[model samples]
Target: MINKIVAIQGNHPSKLNSETDTSVFLAHEIQSKNYKIFYYDPKDLSVINSKVIASGFFIKFNYKDKKFFKILKKQKLNLTKCKFILIRQDPPFNLEYISATYILDTIKDKVKILNNPTSIRNVSEKLYSARYQKFMPSTIFTQNISEIKNFFKIHKKVIIKPIHSYGGNDIHLLNKFNSKLINQFIKRHDHIMCQKFLPKISKGDKRVFLINGQVCGAISRVPKHGSFLSNMSKGAKPINVQLTKTEHKISKLIAKDLKKENIFFAGIDFIDQKLNGDINVTSPTGLKTLYDLSGVNLAKIFWKELKA
Candidate 1:
């Protein structure tokens, strides 16, 4: 008999917020279909005697309970025996993350892995969007101090982001050129992304969900008072929104491209109808928030497209 198991490679459950977490939302959806969830951290994955084994526990998520998740049992699991595996970890995309993908690569053919292990490794979340730079704000990816200075001089106001960081952490908006700050930022984050700041960001940004290379649905995230970041992990408020004609065109083009790259699911952002330079393929989020804002459930769409 086929094991009715879906393994999730992610952080510990205590660190995950069930209300806004896409992993939890997805786990909940699949669990209702009678699939058992095997929860494990990427650090615990190992290739033992040519078998991909993961040290984790079976879990059940209860959205209605104050305590959201219940860990049933702790054991080592042979991942190849599972029907599907979901890489649901958040990113700093460090070496450990890359190594996990490499290990998963071994058994990818045997088990269905969402967003394909090899594809996620090959695609740098921010760098992959460089192909669509014409649709993005004036942006540059570098760690060179002189180059950053030149870009800042040209743009006047700029937004600086760590290339591998996620969830709006270590992102800064600079209105003035400060040599010390630039040096410090480069030292901390190696290569960084610098973009021309759009003042209209106060209005909000649109997050478009792409599933199976199709433009599934989208939601608007409005930054909290005085903040410029639109990540929901920050205080951004999510609301229902419609894509403009231009937004739809851009999204469709990107969705097709990502699908070609073997990415099963993704999320892209837009500001004032221009691409925001983030192609969130590593661990794309916002499904739960999107469902809460709009009755449209992309989780259902995600699984339906996968036929998992």
Candidate 2:
């Protein structure tokens, strides 16, 4: 039998926002069920003598406390012993991240990993949305300057993003084609995601949360003044919002596809009912913010689904 423990492979708790972190929120809920929480950073994961292990510590989470989390004891753990392991690290999705997934893949049969390591490794967060391009704004994935120029000519306004980045970093809004900027961006990040700029983003974007193949909840994040990015890390304010019929339909289709791919949790974004190309499976967030605005505890739903 699997022990009542959930191992989280993520960043240090101190770096997380207590009010909006989904990892800690889920951990806290699972802890209430008397499941021990083992927390570790990706750097501490390793494979030795054909076994997966991690240097980590047991932790307790408290939402109302100023400190929020407390470390109980430090230990080296065999990851296969846990009932579940969540790959909750933030991403540039570089070699280090890929290596961690490879290591975790070895123990997957013995533990329930939220995303299924192999599946997350195969799904590129931004690029995967291409499969649903019909629901998305006009977008392209390329490093070709000429292709980007053509896209710009058609759309007039465009947004350029590093395909593997997270937290709204290195995203640029270009009103007109600038050869220098486009060339420099391509040189810096290689392949990139370029899309027609959505004007409605000034109002907000909705992040729909899918857990266990179902559209569980959603929250709208309105960008701060003078910004186009609606990520919470970019100071976007989340508000309670209901999904439109179209949004609900799109989310359901995506959720069904993700489940078939063995992805257990994901977040997808939309602006003015049009899908933005972020299929956020790599540590998808927003449960805490949703709860804060709507009083719906997605964390409880998360665990209940896992139990079922």
Candidate 3:
């Protein structure tokens, strides 16, 4: 039997936070299936002789161990040899990220790439939510100071965040719009997403996990004291919760679209039944937190769909 090899494109292990790291949890989950995990950074991939080649080491991780990761071997592999490739790197979605997508798009016919590289490149997590704005809160995509000011005028209280950002970084809750700061924000981020700030966010936001375009499980991420960002990485606490009727309806709608887009997995947020308009696609996290709080093993469901 040919050994199933799953190649993961991600950040170096040195930079990860093991406590709530989703990639590490996923790697460990699949390891039990007797599949070999090949780890590499997106920067380490190249096109050699019309083939996708990734230079990395095979690592085996387990919960019970003195040394957590045991390296089996190192090799330069043509991606065609890989049964599955997971593009799991966190993103700024910069030029380098786009270039990697272009490279990976080449071998997609032969190798199964999760969350399809071409699909991810086409979908800018925050911006892609624009298409379903009727289900979303008052939102706008602009870098101009005047436009943002106009949005704030209508929404009163607004949230301003960078289009290319994730993990709740650079997210700002503006009660009163400041033109100068808005100008500075636009200058820095190039394009920004401005939306009506939902007061219910103080309670929590629902993060729905979709695997193979199916809503598998979800968890509510309650913000820390006096804060509104519900990213687990941003110190939000996960809570066991069920999706409301409205949340389930919206998830179903988006799930169909995601499947059409070839997005194998995605994480989307909701506050007070209103779509937050941040569809976290590139390295969508919070799975470990979900499992910890809800006892719903989404990682198992994720691999089940992948294997199917």
Candidate 4:
């Protein structure tokens, strides 16, 4: 018999705000289905006596209200006791994140781990897109200053981002390359991704949500006035939109491959139908926003795919 317990490895309530969180939306959806929602932070994961365990709470939530949650109980659990584990933490994907994956991988034989710990570890959110270069904008991943300069010279306008960074943080849109700043950026991030800036972004980049290798819904997040970053967290506004044929094709390709990688869910972006080179596997968001804009609650589709 399958255990009905679902453990989510993520931040606590005090650190989350429902307005911008997908974890709460996802957890709430699962809890509403009568599954016990156990929560823990990646830091709370440990390997004790060869058993992977987590210390956290059994939570329940209702999204109908602004304050959307309640902790029904708190306890330490051998992760193997869980029927499923959702790795929902935001990324910088530091050492702690890597350690948590190692611990979770141990109990993966007993508990179904979403996105598959080994697959998640092997897939670099940005760098892994290298395989789909033909579908992407002109992008170079390197630490070499000269290579970046050469790429800038060819592309003219460029965006520089860290291979490991997320939430649109540390992303720079450059009309003209600055050697000093570029060098400093390279110094700060171990491996950097520099791509041709798509002026088409003025129209907005589309975030396509995929669940279990299928396109469930999508939304266009238009950048705030005079901004190049389209991240909703950066003040972008969501607009209901339909995917172009090419966008759907590219997204489906990535979706099928991610499924092959055992990635249960993911979100990818497109700027004028060109892959943005950031496969958001770490913690794919915008489900709530998509629901609000398109009235498609992929959060419901999410649990259905997992059969939670």
Candidate 1's C-alpha runs over 4 A off are none
The reply for model 4, stretches above 4 Å from the true place, is none
For model 3, what is the alpha-carbon lDDT of residue 303?
88
Candidate 4: clashing pairs of residues: none
Across 1-308, the per-residue lDDT of candidate 4 in tens digits comes to 76688888887876887876888888777777678888998888877888887889888877676667788888999888888898988889788878878877777888898878888899899999999999998998999988988898898889999888888999998888798998889889988999988998989999999889998778998999999999988989889999999999888988999998999989999999999988988788898888777678888998888876
Which of the two, 1 or 3, has more TM-score? 1
1 or 3, which is superior by lDDT?
Answer: 1
Please say which candidate is ahead in lDDT: 2 or 3.
2
Q: Give the TM-score of candidate 2.
A: 0.98
TM-score of candidate 4 to 2 decimals: 0.96
- Pick out the ten consecutive residues of candidate 1 with the lowest summed lDDT: 293-302
| Model 1 vs truth, CA RMSD | 0.9
70-116: candidate 3 lDDT, tens digit per residue:
77899898888888888889988899999999999998998888879
Taking the tens digit of each residue's C-alpha lDDT, what string does model 2 give over 49-168?
998989999999998799999999999999989999999999989999999999988888878898899999888999899899999899999999999999999999999999999989
Backbone clash total for model 1 is: 0
lDDT of 1 by residue, 152-240 (tens): 88999999999999999999999999889989999999899999999888999999999998999999999999999998889998989
What's the TM-score of each model vs. the native?
0.98, 0.98, 0.96, 0.96
